[model samples]
Target: MSRVVFTLALAASGLLAQAPTPGPLVRLYPVALDANGQPVTDLTADDFKIVDQTKPQTILAFHKPRNEPAAPHEVLEFSNRTSGVTPHATVILFDMINLLDADRLANWKALDKALPQLESGESVYFYVLNLEGALLPIHAISPPAAGDKTWPQGVATGFDKVMKASSHIRQAQIGAEEQVKRTFKALEDLANKLAAFPGRRDILWVANGLTTVPDPMLPHCNGDWVECSLYVPHLGVTLAKDRVAVDPYALVGNISPDVNYNMDQMALLTGGHFYSRQDVRAVVNQVTQGAVGGYSIFYDPGPDNWNNKWHRVHVTCERKGVKLQLRERYYALPDSRPAVERMKAVLMEAFQNPTDLAEIGVRTKISPLPDGKPGVHLDIRIDPSDLLLREQGGKYSGALYCLVSDRSATAPLGEPSVLDLKPELTAEQYKMVMKNGLPFMQDHPTSDTAREVRVIILDQNTNAVGSVTFSVK
Candidate 1:
């Protein structure tokens, strides 16, 4: 589903005000290993230092190895609150866009052989990038049943069928340029979806390799006629020299430099690793083993210049004989859109994969109104402490954005609502808000045919999102 509803309740309401753009808060997932290449789990924040562009940055938050249990398949309902709290998720992406037919088959066989070795509490999702550029989820195998330790037999069979079908479809489509574009876009989308999860995320990209640049013949032409010869004819102009012919099949067998750069960036930003041309068995083994534990470090790069430049980050340990792996850089400029507008964009993206985000906690109740109106009463409660609020001029200020939608009709029930909280309260009142939580109640018209209701909530101050889906009964 492309859209999900988000609901938020704040203590106070006022006109929405634009806050100054703050520097990006960069979160890194660093893996420390000993000489034997075993994961090192004993390191603390004081033992490490982060340097950005040669400037030292103070670590804002540090989390130790967080290894939580994976949600079971039987309890994996998308419309429930508890199902959203996945601590770790691993996506095994089979890149059909960049792999040869022989390599694809070999990798598939290798993954098939290694599937049974997955550990308990490991949440693994299998996705394939087809020729049409869709990142299709072929199968998901959560922790097996209580007594059963092996991968589910039915799930494995379903995966095989889906993979075969996807491969056939991808093989029939022509043109490498389109494939490259689609693959990169899919990777970016996946990264955004995973941003909502507050745990370790590993993307095991199994492919031949990636290119950093698309085919020169199919260069991205953004209004420059010289660069986009395809537009020359439409512009009533022709080149004196013979026009450079575009061989659609020329990029069919080769990777580009741009693709390589894009893939590497996605892996680093999301605290995941990238692999290419590796044995499927070895890749699977590494992913399964590496999923055990990792450290998350948050740092705020103070006062961005908005120069829109890439800043390199170097993290090192004070202790000797330990190697660290983490993302190297992040952009300095913030999203130019207003915070509320950005929140809406984030909400739309989160709707594509609602379960990926579980930062904010919420409870929702829906009941038919006793007045016999053709509508349902919606009550939503949000923990105030979960929101990132700032105290300004003796008042606590925060912002919230909420949306409710009908999944079947693919339309919003009403215009999105924004709550700008600026409550001037005594210390006792503030404490009460923290303890009792923010509660909001509203009644909205509904249709009998609408069987599902999706709600999405966003804390504009923090950009943390919480989403829930409920059956209309």
Candidate 2:
């Protein structure tokens, strides 16, 4: 069988058979900064007051956001690092899709001068959104090899080649209204990739102007420019779901304040700042500050609060002149069938997609089964903290849905096999789980011809995902 679904008849694991519990407790990551824009490192849970729909809710828990590297995992291991609560990442998207010729030149020349000066190993990323509205990576999210040029050096030396190649791939210009739609779509897709990773994600959206994102709808809104953007609430929810903050930076100097009101609103709505004018170095500085130096606070929105509406969220800090940035709004509606269908689509896509998602950190071990069947035994350990657990009665309850695909089977696959992991933990069990990791062990039958096995795991509460692909030895 070529490309069959891996059966998840889990080998009698303790928690795999339990019924899944209802999800509770929403989490938010908000950035706290001083008047001079420096991070406030010492803020505690008592220092914050979270409001939902004009009602003040008590802060249940909070943690200062930091990049804590994980302890070593097993060999041949792949980790998404969701469990460690990795520090924020910054993506610098040079928006050639919207910039004019003159502005594009000025934008890149500034980049050419400032890129090489970035500290050698900062977590800042670089990409170019081409005229076709397709995203191309200028610098991948990996360390450079020894004796190899860094991305900054590469950009400084060969910036023209990058720009030319991106332009050469352009098709017929997508119309103004379509440009707006596509731009938002591309941004949402980008956010989904970052969703699997925890902590804040800062996107430095570099464009001189993006007035076309809603060209057709703009004329109908009278003078309430931001009202149209508000109705397009899915974009805001997607950013918030992924814990992403958008920092809109002007591509060229002296941009008129009236040019891109929507982006400025986006910056505020997502807890990121809008840059009116800045050189290349300043852009890096702003993005780094926005990403790493921040805080993550979680609050219980009460049982009656999830009433499927667009709820406004605001955070207030007790310290004077300490500005707070967070996603101000989110749609409370949780889709029914679409979510299941979406994960299935993603599982199918994982076989060919180059990158594996890390929002839900996952580590797995594969070994040969001792039985006569020519299959492999799978052992999975997930970062327990990444699961959305709620304490009810005397137990902590949460669940995970796992999907696996294998092309190396003898029979054609049927509807995908879903593995449900609803762990039931008492106080002692929960403590043990926190000390060790969450484990899911199963024996999966594989064909001798099996080449690769792809697994996708997701938290049912938030739909945060992590995936890994391992070769059959």
Give RMSD to native, each candidate. 10.6, 6.2
Model 1 weakest 10-residue run by lDDT: 239-248
Query: In angstroms, what RMSD does candidate 1 have relative to the true structure?
Result: 10.6
List candidate 1 segments past 4 Å from native: 1-14, 18-49, 58-85, 96-106, 116-123, 127-201, 208-270, 274-304, 316-325, 331-334, 347-356, 365-386, 391-398, 402-411, 422-455
How does model 2 score by TM-score? 0.71
Model 2 worst lDDT run, 10 consecutive residues: 1-10
Task: List lDDT for all candidates, in order.
Answer: 0.54, 0.65
Residue-level lDDT of model 1, residues 348-460, one tens digit each, is: 75565534244455666777878798766777766564565556676665656555655454443433334333334456666877765566766656676665666666766
Q: Give the C-alpha miss distance for residue 211 in model 2, angstroms.
A: 2.1
TM-score of each: 0.58, 0.71
Which lDDT value does model 2 have at 143? 28
Clash pairs (backbone) in predicted model 2: 1-409, 1-410, 1-411, 3-407, 180-213, 196-358, 196-359, 197-359, 408-450
Error of 1 at 73 (Å): 18
Candidate topping TM-score: 2
